[model samples]
Target: MTRYQPRHTADVRDTGRRLLVRGGAAATVMGAATLGLPGAAQAALPMLRYGSRGSAVVTLQKKLRTLGYSVSTDGIFGPNVLRNVKAFQRRAKLGVDGIVGPNTWAALDRATSGGSEPDPQPEPSDPKPEPSDPKPEPKPTGSRPMLRPGSRGSHVTYLQRQLSSHGFWVGSIDGSYGHLTSQAVMCLQKTYGLGRDGVCGPNTWSAVGRISRPRAAYYSGNGIEIDLRRQVLRVVEGGRVKWAFNTSTGTSRTPTPRGTYRNFRRVNKMDYSPLGKLWRPVYFYRGYAIHGSTSIPGYPASHGCARVSNAAMDYIWARNLAPIGRSVRVY
Candidate 1:
């Protein structure tokens, strides 16, 4: 067995919420776009910027306080308020001008209150021939329910729905937990920095609650998307993700370059200097390939390459998935 140290972090943002739990606990967790529109009384809230003050400022301050910001909710626009606003702006990837105008207000409203997640991407084609599973009814749980291989129920169906909604192949929605569903759940667990236990529990359930759909590079084309954050390598054919693989990408020191690239060379098998051996290596970036590893951890561990399991790499080559001239996108 490939041995690598496991590192798990409780990345639940102060504002990020849990999945399934409702009531007052719901306030402690998140729902999709719950913050999208400001509160009912926020329609008249003024555009706030540096030096602006009054009830509108109070509204912004209260929103910030509710979002776990350290700023006071005193309704006075001050240095503290500006700092929190700018930080929120940066975290949300909105304009960093610190001005709470229409755009900023809209973004802040859409911001995740706790445990921030990526915005949902456009839904891809259904991976299975059958109808997609219906959404599961939510309920509070005493403890995080763990769904592993051999598990079966409506929850399994719900889990399958979550995976397919995010473009991962869960095989089918028959509510039977099997290898394919296990693989899909593993990919999802890996993507969100959760433990690669092939078990869907609270953290995974919460992650599934907030689906981050991956997009193709251009408006339309067959391509490969290597998402570092999601740790997924998506095979995009005709501008939609047809398949996905859990990939272990580069570390912080040797980060994978973010851009569009193409396969330039390949090797059936090679014994690299420190990497030992790479299988079905298809090179795109310098020395970096969508290759195979006996030990593809859930997190970033490679020097700079995108790595899948040996079998997955074989599947890619067998199908001529990453032929020369095909786009490989890392974003």
Candidate 2:
């Protein structure tokens, strides 16, 4: 799937409006069908266009390439690709409109199914270095270690930039692996079930590269706003409130430290109380959380953490985003 990044400066309002309408239409169909209405017009639903690598586009690209067309298998839809597709359509005596419809798909399917591409070149292998008399120095602890862009030995920094572009928060991408970067890496790693070491190794890099699809949406510099007086947490993305949740702050000395903190690790089931029990851990730093509260009738009651219904906690966990050190502004 193409990764969708929010192009804040782009004129996509119209496109979004169209999508909204389409989504509404789809909803209407579902609603009608649920009521036992017939006439949903399921067949009239348009075939979704897959630009590249996806099932449809991949089929088109492969067929074109098989017929000795000079287009890379990269899943981007550009003029060159469209031109080649048009040429193929012409040669195949198809619609010749350059668009791949069901007819074009049938023709291409017949042409390339018999033969496949040559084997891809094997990657080069590097032997591990022999252990030296002096062992390597141990890396530092606390926060995460990341590299700065344009710095020597900056592979980590470059990786951070890529992750940032893919909507993973890594704190400024300044190259220093601090708490934010580590936290971001951990979140991504957990999501993908990779080792949560917070280090961008080969596996992590491969995953990051896969995020080029949809162009990798990112959070704007607009900060997260918390209204302590109102006891609400407002999530703002690109200057808009994506969501707002009612929450309970701290009380007395340990009163929920009301300040900005980026979100990090997330646990669906975690143990709080230092005694190591089972509870879900949400936001990091100070151990304050947004979790189940049977007793929270309203107002401040948590030791310092935010108290939300278990159901709300699940929602927050799913939408929980703290790209290491993403500002958690509390006021």
Candidate 3:
């Protein structure tokens, strides 16, 4: 008979097993592809901007240094880094957003590969006059921009650093012109007998250049002095004004006691009194404490207590500046 011989059973089983194995392999690969496996899971470059801080910032700073940018690799993307980044962007003919994005990264890489010279550092329109200069030069309004509560960028950082150097507390040296900066500006205005508008106008900038560290009225030892006339508080140590804060003393109805007293009590948390909420109060006299308040205006607006910002009060608590047995002098 011409009938074909039956295929071997073992051969049939082997062929089926091979097909199954190939099918399973294909399924696994397909599944991996569907789930975006190994190849597609690689991390993309991060977009870095101002206020960024971390290993990524360090890497960016290193790359900037390789391109001869004069930026400190401190991992903090502050004003210096922002300025350098803007300069790089301008050189690359990219948008000067001060943000290190993919395009900026590519430009930096291309520039480094080509070994291009670093761009010239940006010159300030109105260079800050030295504090020790006998004649403080006036920065004309036409050259300098007026900075208010919403203003931002390197200029705000400059203002913050200037205020800090003058012993005024403006919270952090961040570039954002927030409430603390406004309060510090107001304090400066009050000290210089300018209009307390809390805006850095031409007159305010003039005052900033002329402002100097205030001398403590009481040069005995470590003490807290509140100048009601200036609406400022000075933390004196070793007979020198260590730090100053914008403070609001009592109103006309209830004026702060003008005397020297010892801080007998300290309330670490919020204290509810008949007048209002007192945050981290350091009581110097009867119902009169140098405490923190939310409404510390440029002028007197408190209820017989020297009102400072809540952040200032926290700083006092942290440094033990206003502790029990500390002298409190009000003038």
Best by lDDT: 3
- 268, model 2: CA deviation in Å? 2.5
Candidate 1 stretches with Cα past 4 Å from truth are 1-144, 149-166, 170-183, 189-198, 206-213, 217-219, 269-274
Clashes of each: 8, 20, 0
The Cα error of candidate 3 at residue 299, in Å, is 1.5
Could you tell me how far off, in angstroms, the CA of residue 19 lies in candidate 2 after the best superposition? 50
How high is the lDDT of residue 142 in model 3?
A: 64
lDDT of 3 by residue, 1-331 (tens): 3988666856755555565577785544544444444532112347899999998898888666555354666899998789778867866679999999877877776665554533322211225442342233335556668999889877777777677776777755556787778888988888889998889998998887777877889856899999999999998888877678899998999899998899998887889987689988989998889887778887899889999877667657755778788898899
lDDT of 1: 0.68
Mind giving the per-residue lDDT tens digits that candidate 2 earns over 239-324? Answer: 54444444556766557776667767566564566412324655645565545453333356567776544433443443443344
Residue 48 displacement (Å), model 3:
18
* TM-score per model over all chains: 0.49, 0.32, 0.59
Residue-level lDDT of model 1, residues 1-331, one tens digit each, is 5999534423333233444244454453233234333353344446788888788897787566444343545778897678668766765677788888876676666643433422211134524353445644565453446788888777787777668667775543446676556767878776667888678877788888776765665527788989898788888888777667778889999787889899998887654735446777888987788897766666788888898766556546645778998888898
Arranged by lDDT, best first: 3, 1, 2
Best by TM-score: 3
Give the better candidate number (2 or 3) by lDDT: 3
Worst 10 residues of 2 by lDDT: 117-126
Name the lDDT value of residue 169 in candidate 3. 72
lDDT of each: 0.68, 0.49, 0.75
